[model samples]
Target: MPAPNAAAVPVTADHGSATWRLIKAESKLCLRDKVAPLWGVGFPLIVLIILGAIPTLREPVEGGGGLTYFDFYVPVLILFNLAILATAALPITLAGYRESGVLRRLRTTPIGPARVLTAQLVASFAIALVAMILFLAVAGLGFGVDLPRNPFGFAVAWLLAAAALLSIGLLITALAPGRGPASAIGTVLFFPLMFFAGLWVPIPQMPPVLQTISYYTPLGAGMRAFQDAYQGNFPSILPLVILTAYAAGCSLIAVRWFRWE
Candidate 1:
């Protein structure tokens, strides 16, 4: 027989291959769920197209400091896409997996529970990122909204915000006992986050009190950081700190409370 260490190498390689297969399978599942992509990608693009059709929205506005209303909404739509993925789609799928015994069944395999969870998360994250890129392309080519000027800064801020939002998604899954509850809670949280992020109202135009309050919300702070990067400025330290805290804190809570069943 070959040496034990040599035998172990095949096992490790096999495990890695298994993980990739799992990620691909999860990705396929996401794709099959047409509604998820509809809300996560299509809806935002449609809204942007509709908004772009308005002549006034394309022109510079006093409230927007010479940037058109369309310019301000581009980042908001990107964030909105991310939010829908993290809050609505991710939690529901994970919770469904848990409820249907898929996760529990994986416990008996070489892959292990954590690796399976990681695969699912990675798949979902990839989908969200793809949706964001599509949004950027459409915004740039169709609407003439400038891409984020500071690409590196914008990327960092986006990754941090995605982590924070995804952590919140996991936390929601951990607490919700079933798919219905998970979706319900995610939907409830989604609207408020959108409002504070200035989905319906521009952050600059919000009352001073609401603006101050929005600064503390994850999407709110994230929108500010994203907007700043859109205009070629480094994001403020406070919003970065808030994003970090939400990511770290919510991840800890999720891990601590997650149920395999």
Candidate 2:
């Protein structure tokens, strides 16, 4: 009988080609996915264009160190893009693959569940990065919005936030029973998280109590980090710590509970 895990590629072999191919395939699948492409990439760019067209949004945010309302929202939308990819698109697709036995079947091939998971993560990260660049491009060229002043700090914050969000995605996939539940759970998370990310009201405009609460939410901390980067400073330690904690805690739990079949 074939070993169930015959597909688990081991070290000491040049597995780079296989890994690269898997990533390419997964990235193609992500691009072909209607829901993720629509909401994750297209939605954010469209909203950015609309916001840029609004003259009122060009006004400077009070106490934002000369950042326009449009500028503030650029990072919010970036966070939103990541949220959709992580919470909605990723969990749902993986759960569906699980439900349909795709992950289980892969164990019999040259590629295994672990590699597939890595490919999915790479695809999602690539998509998120592309969407972010698109957002910045449209904002900069079409609307004259400046890039983040602290580019290194901005990159750091973005990486941490992505790790935190994607780890949560894996946790959702590990915990949910099937695709439907995963989608439902993701939907339930999407709105409230976006709320804390300042999707509507500016964080500063929020009531003091809510502002205090916001900093504790995932996107809230991420938005704070992005804002600090935009203002030419490293993100505060609190938000970075919060993001790292989430990434570590959730990833450990997800790995503990994740199943192949």
Candidate 3:
């Protein structure tokens, strides 16, 4: 039998163009999904309102001056919303693309498979940024939450948190090849992370053991870092450091195990 012809393999020199095309396509598709945008953005805002309405939340802090519970919880709420969207939506989108042969089909085209992944990342990040802006707007305008005193610190914290969450999402997509299972895994992670991270209840109110564990969880650390930024507190090096480490570890696992087909 004759050996297979290597010349039949597809290759393209204009990979950058292909990547841009994929990014645009992904953006359009994501925007057209009414339910996703509602769930990703609206649900979080609703949670913020409900949490902010709690009587204890509205009462002044005992010794931390007169900051309202709404003011104090706003940062945690924003980060929690962003984390949930990243964890839940990203994995499902990726796994669905893979399961539906979107990635496999792209391999036969001039576009590289990596472009599809990049497009998905860019689209997801865009949605995340919008959610962050909406959260900030609502808090600042509607609830009298002040802007971050250190804008630079706030930006750094946000970027690091996004990176950490994105890495975890990618890791989930790599490990769970099917869309249903990927969503299930994300659901398993979503609530606990949010609750322990102080999205539902104040960390100080939790039991000592739970508080200790929460401090070490990625979502908790991210929320703490965000809270520090919003309150104009000096950036806490530990949470950012832990987030960086988690991002690195998750990225490594994702890259090693990811499959296109």
Model 1 C-alpha lDDT versus the unseen true structure: 0.83
Q: Point out the higher-scoring one by lDDT: 1 or 2.
A: 2
TM-score of 2: 0.87
Q: Model 2: how large is the Cα RMSD against the reference?
A: 4.2
List model 2 lDDT by residue over 1-261, tens digit each.
Answer: 969897785663555677788898878887787767887789888988998899899999788778788888889999999999989988987888788887778767876545666777788888888888998899899988899999999999999999889888888877776899999999999899999999988898899999999998889999999999988999999999999998888877777777665
Two-way TM-score contest, 1 vs 2, winner:
1
**Leading candidate by lDDT:** 2
Clashing pairs in 3: none
Worst 10 residues of 1 by lDDT: 7-16
What's each prediction's TM-score? 0.89, 0.87, 0.85
Give candidate 2 regions above 4 Å deviation.
Answer: 1-21, 62-65, 107-114
lDDT (10s digit) by residue, model 1, range 1-261: 878688555555645688788888888888897656777778877887888889988889775567898888888888888788778888888888888987778767787645655666787678778788988898899878888889988998899898888888878877777799999999999999999999999887899999999999999989988987988898888899999999899877887777778
Candidate 3: tens digits of C-alpha lDDT, residues 144-257: 778888778888888888778877887887777778998899999888888878866788899999988887788888877887877777569999998898778887778777
- Segments in model 3 whose C-alpha atoms lie over 4 Å from true places: 1-16, 52-56, 109-114
